[model samples]
Target: MTDDLLTRVDNGVGIATLNRPKALNSLNQPMVDALGEVLAGWASDDEIRAVVLDGAGERGLCAGGDVVAIRESALRDGVAAAKFWFDEYRLNAAIGGYPKPYVSLMDGIVMGGGVGVGAHGNVRVVTDTTKMAMPEVGIGFIPDVGGTYLLSRAPGGLGLHAGLTGSVFTGADAIALGFADHYVPHQRLTDFTAEIVAADVHTALSRYAVTPPASALAAAREWIDECYAAGSVTEIIAALRGHDAPGAQQAADVIETRSPIALSVTLEAVRRAAGLGSLAEVLVQEYRVSCASLRSHDLVEGIRAQLVDKDRNPKWSPATLAEVTPDAVSAYFAPADPDLTF
Candidate 1:
């Protein structure tokens, strides 16, 4: 509680450590506010030429948002919960568009909110321990925090598959999908950090980037693209079910367990984000989609099933992909007078 985000400077590099190791550095309202403040301060500071974000624990960089707090806040005062999400989204947008050389040493599990912060950085470093994903569908929430934008740009149908299935990927998949810029062994991070700390502010650090020896995921792109190219959630499910690979079955099981409504919305969100004009534009659209998600979707029930009750069977609103009406899905994209202007 005392230490959420720890800030320090080493040879002009401003390093922000997400310090809630017990929670895998999950983002809470206070942590989001703290990040916004720190980012705002660093935006104009010339001395802090680079920024490095890392997590404190062995398990990962950051896991996801603090769902317990979100649920509690919603139960207490719905307006407060809305405000918190709005502020958190703003912080995510700011980081996505931040001008400085922002780097993330994504050493372990990076998912949900973590991907928005780490993978969106200018220099995203993945390690052998890194396992990346945008798994909002698993918890009955559509991916937010500008994830729709990033997922939209991923090669082939990878975005659609990932958004709908809540599939976890290794550091290798991250690099193949363009989510991460470089891959290095976790063991080399300390030496790499020292090199970064020692370098002059004006010097470009691209030379120090370490890409791992070619990974097998790149070779499996054909299968990934072909199997995931289906436009609808049901089609993708059918395709996955037909595949004999262990990876395909694992992904299918995950899809089977998630909220139907959340998965549909996530697929739609990524597709919509892909057509947007800019990252900021996509983020604003995501904000609209997210605000609508709280009231119109099965997020509450999803959380209840998976977290509150510990019952994995979530009674999704629509129950199946076909039951989700086009009008109901379109409502999430409807414009507001005081629209989400990220």
Candidate 2:
């Protein structure tokens, strides 16, 4: 459909490849539109039984949406960034509610917007090289693209830990945290997809998928559940610091480095998502948060530090956790002007 996104049909399966290997196949406006168009066209075609998403290079499936573009737009009118998210969030919902089986080959470096596209599919496959993360907190953004919905549904504190700390977890951790289903080694990925194209999704899964290795999250669940069970972000961090688990103190330290206001809003967003009945409902809430974030100083600064300047030093407005008031965080919940509709 476009240079950034390549689409093809083989047998009964429609295959789409993200073609920007050098930039980790980071999604742009055109790629997102192409994916939506392809999926919409395939949704009604009786000849296509399933759809698969893959990245062109060996590096990864997708890093994320073009945040650098978002940063530039945010530095401008913020209109373009909003439109990108509006369409991208809709695409995320379409993938989740797709009529036919949607398969996501989540091989490596799947993060943020990447999770929106790859993890929402019904048949999500992960490999050992897969490193999935919702690292928005690191860039002064909340996890959108139904990330709150997926993470909120994760067992106990694992989801909150991921959202707050912005840490990357392995494929085993991805499966444990409910981000993916079957495990197929990278070496067999091509053969496995061929199986799906030749036969059907289930048959391919049965033939090549195997049990993933033990996840670190599974072992840390005892303390993770206990610490993250706190009602608020502050309390959660304190609990992590006080806990004796292997990753607890480290998680607390990592969260301390993120934008304070972003962390506060992210905590509330994930918590609110837990109560939402469906992914669409959660997306609506996420849209509100995303719009609110665009107006905030942190989002632009976050992107500048992480992408534009590569300084890795964002001076968040509210520098400390205690400085972030409840009202400041509540502003992110207000209804967006150009609202998102399903």
For this target, which candidate reaches the highest TM-score against the unseen true structure? 2
lDDT of 1 by residue, 1-342 (tens): 237999888887889988899988988878888888887788789888888888997899999888766666655555656776778777777887888988888889898878877877888889889888888887778888778887888888777767777778788778877788887688877767777788842233454556666755556666667778887778888888888777677777878788777887788888888889776787778777766766744777777777789877778878877888877878888774356665
Native-vs-model 1 lDDT?
0.78
Compared with the true structure, what per-residue lDDT tens digits does model 2 show for residues 1-342? 689999899998999999999999999999999999999999999999999999999899999999999988888988999999999999999999999999999998999989999999999999989989999999899999999998999988889988999899999999999999999998999999999999999999999999999999888999999998998888998999899876899998899999999999999999999999999999999999998888889999999999989999999998888899999999999988878998
Off by over 4 Å in 1: 200-208, 213-217, 243-246
Top lDDT: which candidate number?
Answer: 2
Q: Write down the lDDT of every candidate, Cα atoms only.
A: 0.78, 0.93
The positional error of residue 212 in candidate 2, measured at the CA in angstroms, is 1.0
